[model samples]
Target chain A: AQTVTQSQPEMSVQEAETVTLSCTYDTSESDYYLFWYKQPPSRQMILVIRQEAYKQQNATENRFSVNFQKAAKSFSLKISDSQLGDAAMYFCAYTPGGSQGNLIFGKGTKLSVKP
Target chain B: NAGVTQTPKFRILKIGQSMTLQCTQDMNHNYMYWYRQDPGMGLKLIYYSVGAGITDKGEVPNGYNVSRSTTEDFPLRLELAAPSQTSVYFCASSYRGSNTGELFFGEGSRLTVL
Candidate 1:
C-alpha cells in the first residue's frame, strides 16, 4: 500500500511571493505518478500539476511546479507569484502504474495567500 | 458535457438511516471512483469500478457500498449511517489505458449524519 504524507498542516505566503508545500510518500512500486490537487472553499477539486516518477525533470505549469525527488520519495509543490486565489487546501496524491489503481492522498496543507 | 455529476449536493440523515449518492459520467470513462473528504483529511477512496458490473473496495470501504450497472452510472450507498460517516463525497472518472490519465471530478455531495 502506498501512503502520502503532507507534514505541513498550514502554510501562508504574502501576495506575489512564493510558497512550497512539502509532501512525502511510501511506495515500493518503481513506476508511479504524483499529483497536486487544489480544493478551494467552493469545494471543487482542481488539478494543479502532475509528475511522472520516471521523469527526472520536474513538472511545471504556469505558477505551479513540483520538486520531485524520487530517491527521497519526496514530491513538493511550489507556487510562485502567489495570489489570493491560491488560498486553498493542497493535496499530494500517488497512483501506481496499472489499471484500476486508486489514488492515495495526503492529509493536505492549507495554503493562505495574504494580501 | 456533464463530465461527472453527483446528486443531492447536501443531505442530512438520522442515525441508522440509509441513502444513495448518485453519480453519473457521460464521458464513457471506464474507471469511476468514490472518495470522501473530511476536515484536514484529503480524499479517501471508498470504492471504485473499472467498468460496469465490476466494483472493488478501496482504502476506506467500510460502511459503504457501490454498484456500477452501466458505464455511465456508478452509485454509492450507505446503510445504517453513522456520525462518523458525515463527510463530503466526490465522484471522479478517467479514461481507459493510462493509469495516470487525469481525473474529472464532480462538484461533490455533502452528507451530514445526525
Candidate 2:
C-alpha cells in the first residue's frame, strides 16, 4: 500500500508572495506518478500539476510547479505570486504505475493567502 | 463539457435512512471513482469502476455500495446512513491508462447524516 503525507495542516502566504506545500509518499514501486490538486471554495477538485516519476525534470503550470525528488520520495508544490484566489485545500496524491486509476491522497494543507 | 455531474448537491438524512447519490460523466472516461472528504481530511476513495458492469471497493467502502450499469453513470448507495458517513462526496472520472491522466471532478455532493 502507498501512503502520502502532508505534514502541514495549514499554511498562509501574503499576497504576491510565494508558498511551498510539502508532500512525501512511501511506495515500493519504481514507477509511479505524483499529483497536486486544489479544491477551492466551490468544492471543485482541480488538477494543479502532475509529475511522472521517471522524469527528472519537475512539472510546472502557470503559477504552480512541483519539486519532485524521486529518490527522496518527496513531491512538493510551489505557488508563485500567490493571490487570494489561491487560497484553498491542496492535496498531494500518488498513483502507482500499471495500477488502476485509484489515487492515494495526503491529509491536505489548507492554504490561506492574505492580502 | 459537463465533465462530471453529481446530483442532490446537498442532503440531510437521519439514521438508517437510505439514499442514492447520482453521478454521470460526459467525458467518455472509462474509469470513474467515488470519494468522501471530511473536514480537514483528504479525500478517501470509497469505490471505483473501470468500465460498465465492473466495480470494486476502495479504502473506505464499509457503508457504501456502487453500481456502474452504463459507461457514463456510476451511482453510490448508502443503505443505512450513519453519523460517521457525514461528509462531502465527490465524483471523478479519468481516462484509463498508466499515463496517470488527471481526474475531472464534479462540484460535489454534501451529505449530512444526523
lDDT of 2 by residue, B1-114 (tens): 688999999999999999999999998989999999998888998999889999998889999999998999999999999999999999999886424757899999999999
Q: What share of the true interface contacts does each candidate keep?
A: 0.56, 0.56
lDDT of 2 by residue, A1-115 (tens): 7899999999999999999999999999998888999989999999888898999999999999999988899999999999999999999998888767568889999999999
Candidate achieving the largest lDDT: 2
**Residue-wise lDDT of candidate 1 within B1-114, one digit each (tens)?**
678999989999999999999999999999899999997798988999988999999889999999999999999999999999999999999886226648888999999999
TM-score of each: 0.95, 0.96
> What TM-score does prediction 2 earn?
0.96
Docking class of 1: medium
Tens digits of per-residue lDDT, candidate 1, A1-115, equal 6799999999999999999999999999999889999989988888889898889999999999989999999999999999999999999988888746488889999999999
| Candidate 2 stretches greater than 4 Å from native | B97-99
Work out candidate 2's RMSD over C-alphas: 1.3
Candidate 1 residue A66 Cα shift, in angstroms, is 0.9
